[model samples]
Target: MTSSSKISRRSLLKAGGSIGLLAAATQIKTSWAMGGRSRVGVNSPEQLLALSAVDLSQAIRTGEVSCVEVMKSYLSQIDNFNPTYNAVVSLRDREELLNEAAVADADLKSGHYRGWMHGFPHAVKDLATTKGLKTSMGSPILKDWVPKHDAIFVERLRQSGAIIIGKTNTPEFGLGSQTYNNVFGITRNAYNPDLCAGGSSGGAAVAVATGMLPVADGSDMMGSLRNPAGYNNIIGFRPSQGLIPFGPTKEVFYQQLGYEGPMGRTVQDTSMLLSTMAGYDSRVPLSQKSSPSRFAGSLETKTQGLKVAWLGDFNGYLAMEPGVIDLCEKALKHFETLGGVVEAIDMQYPMDEVWQTWLTLRHFLIAGGANGLYAKESNRVLMKPEAIWEIEGGLGLSAMDVYKASKARTSWYHALDKLFDTYDVVALPSAQVFPFAAETHWPKEINGRSMDTYHRWMEVVTPGTLSGCPVVNVPAGFDHQGRPMGIQLIGRNKEDFKVLQIAHAYEQASQLTRTKPNLKKA
Candidate 1:
C-alpha cells in the first residue's frame, strides 16, 4: 500500500462487488488519489501510524514527535490504503492537515498543551456532524451539507487537540449494520477486503484496524459500534445509555435506543477517547451527570472469582453461523485462565418479547429521525426500503402500542437485573453471524431461518441495548477463513467502568489485537 502503486476504483470495484460503488468510486478517486509523501523510505513515519493513541498523544505532547510528522504519516496511510478499504471519505487535503499539525507543534513550543489528545489525528463517524467537514451521513442528498456547529463529541475531540481529518463511511442515514450506501460504496473488512465491514460504525472500525485513523467516534443504534469492531478485530465499547451525551437533536428525551461511543485498536485508547466524549451536557436532558475521567485511568483489574454468564444464542433462539458460537466460546475460555468462572446460561425471560420491544423502540426512533425524509415525495424515493419500513411502522403506532412495548421492555430489564445479581457479567456473541459478502445489503436469513426484518439477524445484541447496560465487543479470534468475531461483555445498568475493567483484563490475557490482520487488496 504505497502511493506509487495506488489502487484504482476498478480494483476497489473488484474488491467490493456492485451495490453502490459508482458514487464511492468517484469520491475515492477525487479525494485520496492526490499523491502524498508515500511510505517509500518512510519507515519511521510508518511506525508512527502504528502507535497506540495514548502513545501518539504523549509523543506529540512532549515534542518527542512533531505533530506535522504524525499527521503526515496518517495522511500517507490514508493515501495508500483508503482507496482499497473505502474506510475514509471526504478527506481533507494533506497540505492543509500538515499545516494544522504545524500549528499544534507551535502550541507545544509555547508550552500550550491542550489535553490528552493533543495533536491526535482523528476522524468522526459520518453520522456525526463536524463543523465545516462534509457530513454526508451516507446519503447523497446531504453530501454537501457542511455543518455550522459540531456535535458535542466532535467539539470534545477538537477541544482535546484532535485534528479532524475527515468522516468515516456509514450506511445511508445509518439505518443498518452493513456499511454501504448511495453516498459511499462499502467499507471492506481489514483482514479480508472482500467481506463486509459491519456497520453503522463500519468505516470507523476499519480506520482504527488498518491505522487509517488512530481512534474514532461512532454512534450505535443497533449493533452499529460493536458489530463493526468485531468484524475488524478492534475494540468498540457502547457505554451505558446517556453515559455520553448524544444529540442536541429534537427527540433526545424519548430516544434511548442509540448511544455514542469510542472505537480503537486497544481498550486503553478506546477508554481514553471515551473520557473525552463522555460527561454531562444540559442540552441532552437525560445525559449522565457522572464524571467520565475514571475510564481514562488504568484498566488493570484482578479477575479472580469473577462470575460471567455466557448467553450463547439464547439457547438456540439466535440462528448463528456454524462456527460463530464456537469461536466466541473459545475466546471466553481466556477468562478461566484469570480465575474467572464461566457458565452457559439459558435465558429465563422470553427472547421474543425482547424482540418485539426492540422492534417498537427501534421503529419509533429510526422513523422519528427519518420521517421528514419519508414525508417529502421527492426525498422519499431517495430513502432505502428499510428506512421507509421504519417510518411507516412508527407512523402507524398508537400510544397504547408504544405503552405495551415499554412495559415489555421493563419486564425484560427486570429479567436481566435478576441475572446480573447472580452473575457479575453476562456475555454473548457480538454478532450472530460472521462478516458476509460486501455486496449484500443485509442478511435476509440465517441458518435456514428467515429474518422477518432487516435487523433481526442481530438479535443477540438487544438485551444489552434495551437494558441500557454497558457492553464491550472483545475480539474473538478469526475463524478458518480468517473472518473475525467478538464476544460481548455486558455489565449492569450504569456500571460502565466495571464492564471496561473486565474487558481490559480479558484483553490483556488474550492479547488479540496484537495479532495484526494480513491485509491484501481484492
Candidate 2:
C-alpha cells in the first residue's frame, strides 16, 4: 500500500473526528521577505515567519538591509506584541544593539562583510547562560543572577555576527511545555492570545512567530524545541545531542536530556543557525569534530527513495488530536510524492516505562545539580514544584533504581537501533494535541484518559530524546480552530544532515509551509 494511503486509513480509524477540532485563531498579517527575497518551502503566513531567519541573512549579505533596521523591526514587533504574548524577557541593552548595528554598517562600508550573519538579530532560550546577562531559567531564585561568561553556543553566535537582542522566556528551570516563570510571567501564543506557545523554548517560538526576532536559539530536553515549534507554527530543530556542544558546566545536566539548537521561520534558516552553532569543543567530551557545512547546503539533497517510518502511535499512549493526525498524514503523502517511501512500524517499548526511565534519569541528574540551590533559603522560595518534584524524585531513587534505569536505556537504545535499521526516517506527531489552552499546561485529561504527569501528554517527543536522534519539527497545518500542529522527522543519531535534507525536501514539496497563522490581537 502507498504510505500516505496507509497513514490516512489508520488515522481515520484511530483519531476519528479529532482532526476536525479547529484552531482558535490564525497568525497576523506580516511581510514574508526581509528585503524582497522570497524563501523556499513557504506558502502561508506561518511559512512566511519560517522564512525570517534566511531572509534576514540574505538581506544582510546583499546590503539590501541594515542590521539596525532589522533589529528595529524585530524590537518594534516585540514592543507592539510582546505585552500580549510575553515571549521575550530581559532584552539586551538597547544601546548595545544600536552600537552593534553601527559596527555592522561600518563593516559594509569598509567592504569587510562578516560572512552570512553580519547583522542579524537573534535570541536564545533563557536557560542558556549569557555572560554578564541575567539568565533566570524561569525561576525567582536566580532572578537576580547573572553569569560572568557566555555559554559556548552563545559565544559562537556572537562570533557569527548575530546580535544577541535578548533572552526568551521558559517554564521554571526549563521543565514544562508551557512557558511561564515567576519573574517574567507567562508567554502566550502569537496566533491566539489565550493559547499556549509551548515550552521550554516557548518564548523562542513566539518571538519567531510574531517577527520579534528572525531566528532564536533554544534547548530541547524532552521536545522543548519541537513542541514549541509546532505550537507556534514555526520550525524547531533538535540536532543530534553532540552536534551542538555545551561547555564550562561542571555538572552533567548538559549530558542528560538537554541539547541546544536553533528555532526559526524556515528550514533554511534553521539549517544556517545549526551550521553556525555546530562544531567540536575540547571542554565538552561528548562533542564531535565535524567539518562545518552550511545547513542550507543540505537542502539541495533530493528526497527521492528516502525511506521513512511513520509511528503515529507508539503502543497507543500517544493519542492524536482529530485533525492533527490527518494534517500530518497529508504531509507524509507529500513526502511519498517526492519519491520517498513511508511505512508503518511497531515499536517495542512501554510508554510508561520510557517516561519513567526518562524522569528517573532527568530528575536524578537535575536534582543532584540543584542541591546548592535547595540549601539556599532565598533560592528555595523560587524553586518550582517541578524542580522540587525532581529533587524529591532524585532523593527517592536508590542506587539500584538508577542502575535499573541505566540498564533499561540499553534496551531502549537497541529498540531504536532496530527501528532505524528498517527506515531512514521516522515520522510522528510532534505533539499529540494542537496548541492547547494558552492559560494552563496541557490538559491533565484528554478525551477522558488521565494524563498523570506534566510530561505524559507530550509522549511523542520521548523517542527522539531518549535515542538522542536528530528530530526536526516541521509545521504541518492548522486545525479547524486555526491552531497550528506539526509532524516530526526523527533521523538516526549522527545523521543530522540527512534529517535536515529530508525535511527540506518535504518542506519544498508539501507547500504546507506557505500557510501562516493569523496573529490575534487581544
Candidate 3:
C-alpha cells in the first residue's frame, strides 16, 4: 500500500497487475520494519491479525495469504477482544463473513483484484451507513434502520476490496467524545478495558489499537479521530477540509468543519487508507479536485530544519491534567533530534472567542443535521443530553449569530495561517488529560479547573478543528497509570502529506509508538 498508484489503471491491464504483484511480493518479503514502516506479519492466524493493512494487502494480492485466512484471523480477534471492549458492534455472522472472504479469495485467483484494499476486512465507524449494515449513529432511534445507500466514503471503501464486516461503536448522535450510548454501550480503551476509548471514533481507534482491524476508516469533527487515537495509542489523521468529500446529505455546502479520514497503527497504513477514502465527488461540490492517490506516496520526508510550534496549554490559557504538558514536551524532543527547531508558542487568537465560534458552528450543524430526531417528541425522548443541549443552543441562535460565528472562525484560521508562515507545523497535546474511566462521560474538571460544558474539557482539539487544516495525532508517551496520550501535529491547510511526513519522522524518532498496550480483558 506504500505506493498504490504505482500500478496505473491503464497499465494494470497491460501488465496484468504485475506492478502490484511485484511490489506486493517485495513488501511480503520484508517483515514488520518499525519507524513508520508497515508491519508485515507471518501468515498464521495470530500473526495474520497482527499485520498492518498495507502489509496485509500486499500479502493478499501476492497470494502469500488468503483472504479467508485473513478474515478468520480478524474475526477470531474480534470474538476474543470485542466482547469485553465492545469496539465492534452489529457484526455480521461469522459464516456469512467467511463466505464473503471465500468469494474474495476466488476473485483474487481469477486476477480480479478490486483495488488497494483487495480482500481486507474492515468496519466503518457507526456513523457511516453501509447499504445493509446498521449505522445506528450510536442511537437507539436508528438502531434498526439500515440505509439503502452508502456514505460517499463507504462507497469508496467498498469500491476498493474492503469487506464491510460490521460497525465500530460511537457516542449518541456523536455528540460527545465519550463512546457510550443506550444502543451499543461503552467502547472501552484498548489498553484498559475500563477506561474511555474516546469517541465518536472510539471503537474505530480501539479496534485498530487491538489489531481487530488492519486499518479503519473514521471521521473527525472535533477530535473524534485524534483524541481516540491519543487514548488508544494508534494513528488518527484528520485530512484538510474538502480533502475527503463527506456526503450525499441534504445540506452539503454548509457542512464545513468535519470530514472523513483514516486510522491505522502506522502513518504509512493511514496514508494508504486515505488514498482510498479521498478524491472528488460530484455530490460534494467542495471536494478537492486532485487525485487522492498522491497521498499513498512514500511517507519519508526530510524534517531537516523543519519548524514546529508547541502550543502547549496555550501559554497556560487552557487547563491540563498533571504531566500532560511534560509528556508532550518530551515528545517534541524527537522533532528536535530530527534537526527540527521546536518553540513554545502562545495562542495567537483569543481562546474564548475561538471557543464561542466553535460552539456556534457545532450547535448550528448538530441542530440542523439531527432536527429529524430533535423535532419529534418521541425521538427526542431517546436523545442524549449533549445532543439536546447542542440542538437547543442552535435553535436559540439567530441567522446573524451564525454569521458572526463564521466570521470568528475565519479570524482564527487567519491567525493560525500566520503561524504557518514561520513554522511548518503547530503541535498541541491531542487531549488535555489522559484516558479516563469509561463509566465517566465527559470529564467534569481538568485538574482543579471546572468545565463549563460537557465538551469543554476537550478544548485542546477545537483549534485544529476550527483551522480546517490537516492534523495528525502521533503517539505521545503514556502516564504513570500506563494510560496513552497523543500529540497532534497541525500542518498547513492543504499540506496533508507534509503533516503525515513530519508525523512519520517523529514516530520514527520517538520510542513511544513502538510500545503496544498490554491488552486487558474484562
Candidate 4:
C-alpha cells in the first residue's frame, strides 16, 4: 500500500479500534519508501546507513530521498538487530513512526522544511525526558512513567524536525559506565554481542553503530558518552561544561558536572546534531551564550601547525588493559601526518587525589538526588545495589569531604589550563579497557591492579570530566581481538568548536569511522 494510504487506514483504525487493532495496524505491508518504491534489501541499507547525517539531511532537503524511506530503512535494521543487541528500549509503535514520516514528507513537498534534521529518525538517551514516551531511565520504578514535557535537548531535536524513535538504554539513573540495569537488562556491544557496550550511553552508541539510528543523543557526567563511543567504535563528543546546559532541575545555580552532547558514526554527523542541541537559555542557568554556527564552521578548520599533547595513561598512573595504550598511541601518530605537532606531555597532578575528589563529589551528587528515593521504604527495593551503595556512601560523606574535593578539582583545572597554554588538544585512550563480557557489571581490576571501587577502572575519563573540558572520542583502531578502541581529544574549556575541528581533522585522516560492525551472526 502507498505510505499515505497506509497512514490513513491506520488513522481510521486508531479512531475506532481497540489497542489490538493498533498493534495489528503496525504489521501492515506499507511501502518501505516514498512513491511506492521499495528500497529495503534492494537498495543497500548499509550504504544508506553509512551516509553522514549532513549528507542525509541534504538528501532529504533536495528530494533525493523522502524521510519515509530513511525511517523505514532504520526501522528495518532495528527490527533485524535490536533484539540481539538490546540497544534501544521503549520503542514507539511502528505505525505511529511511519505516520510521522509521512507527515514530514508532506511538509517537504509543500516547502515547509523544518531544518537540517527534518524528518530524520533519532533516539534520545533514556535518561532524558521525552513527552508522551516512556522515560524509564532504565529503572523499573519508572518503567511506566511518561514525562509531561520533553527535556530541553529533546525539545530542540523535535523543533529541528527529527522524529523521536525511542529511548536508548542506560543504567539506572545513569550511575555507572556499564549500561546494564534491572529494567532492560544489558545493552551489548555492536562489535560483539558477547561483550558489553560501555555506558551509560551504551545503547545510544550501539544504535548508531548497528545502523539502528544515524545519530543519537547522550549525556556525560563521568564519560558516559565517550566510553560507549570508544567501545562501539563511533564518535561521542562531550562538549565543555555549560556549552549545553543540564536542566529541568531544582537548583539552577549549582556546580554542574554532567553535560548533554551528541553521538554519531562520524564527527561531521555529531557536529550536525550538536548544532541543533546547543543554545543560550535563561532556564538553563549554566547554558553558554554561543552560536551553533561556530560548530559547523569549525569543521573546516585545518589541523596543520596545531599542537597536540599525548597523555599516555595519565603519565602511567592509570591502569590500562593490555594493548590499549599502544592502540591509542598509533592513532595519535595520524595527527602528526596531518601537520599536527605531537608532544609527549605529563599532566603531573596527584592521580590518587584526583580520583578521591571525583568520587567524593560524584557520590555527593548521587546521594543528593537519590537519597530521597532511597528514603521511601517501598521504593528502596526497586533501586540497584550499586546505586544503594553510592547513595549511602554520600550520606556518610562530611561537608569537609565535599569542600576538599572541590578544592582538588579547582587545582586540577589549573594544571589542565596550564598545559592547554602549550597545546591545542590533549589526546588519550577513551577507555582504560576494551569491551568486556556483557554479564560483568564492571571490571574488578586492570592489568592485575585491583580496582577499589566499581568505577575505579574507568579513571581514564575522569580527568576530562573533572576538568569540564570538551572531550571527543574518535575511532582509534581495533585490538588483537578486533574489538574497537578510540582516542579521546580533550580541548580547552568552552573551546568546543576547536575540539570538533581537531577531531574532524583526525577523523578525515584516519577514516576509522568508515568501519562497520559485522552483525550477520549477531
Q: Rank the candidates by TM-score, best first.
A: 3, 1, 4, 2
Compare the candidates by lDDT and give the number of the best one: 3
Predict model 2's lDDT versus the native.
0.77
Residue 87, model 2: Cα distance from true site in angstroms: 1.2
**Model 2, which residues run further than 4 Å from truth?**
1-5, 8-51, 252-254, 294-296, 520-522
Model 1, 109-132: lDDT tens digits are 998998988888888899998899
lDDT of 2 by residue, 166-277 (tens): 7899999898888877889889887777888889999998888787787889999889999999887778899887789876699643465788998877787889888888
Locate the minimum summed-lDDT window of 10 residues in model 1.
22-31
- In angstroms, the error of model 3 at 448 is 0.9
* Model 4 alpha-carbon miss at residue 67, Å: 1.5
State TM-scores per candidate.
Answer: 0.91, 0.90, 0.92, 0.90
Better of 3 and 4 by lDDT: 3
Question: Candidate 1 has what TM-score?
Answer: 0.91
Positional deviation of residue 170's Cα in model 3 after best superposition, in angstroms: 0.1
The per-prediction tally of clashing pairs is: 0, 33, 0, 1
TM-score of 3: 0.92
Question: Model 2: how far is 180 from its true place, Å?
Answer: 0.9
470: Cα error in model 3, Å: 0.5
- Candidate 1, residue 478: how far the Cα is off, in Å: 0.8
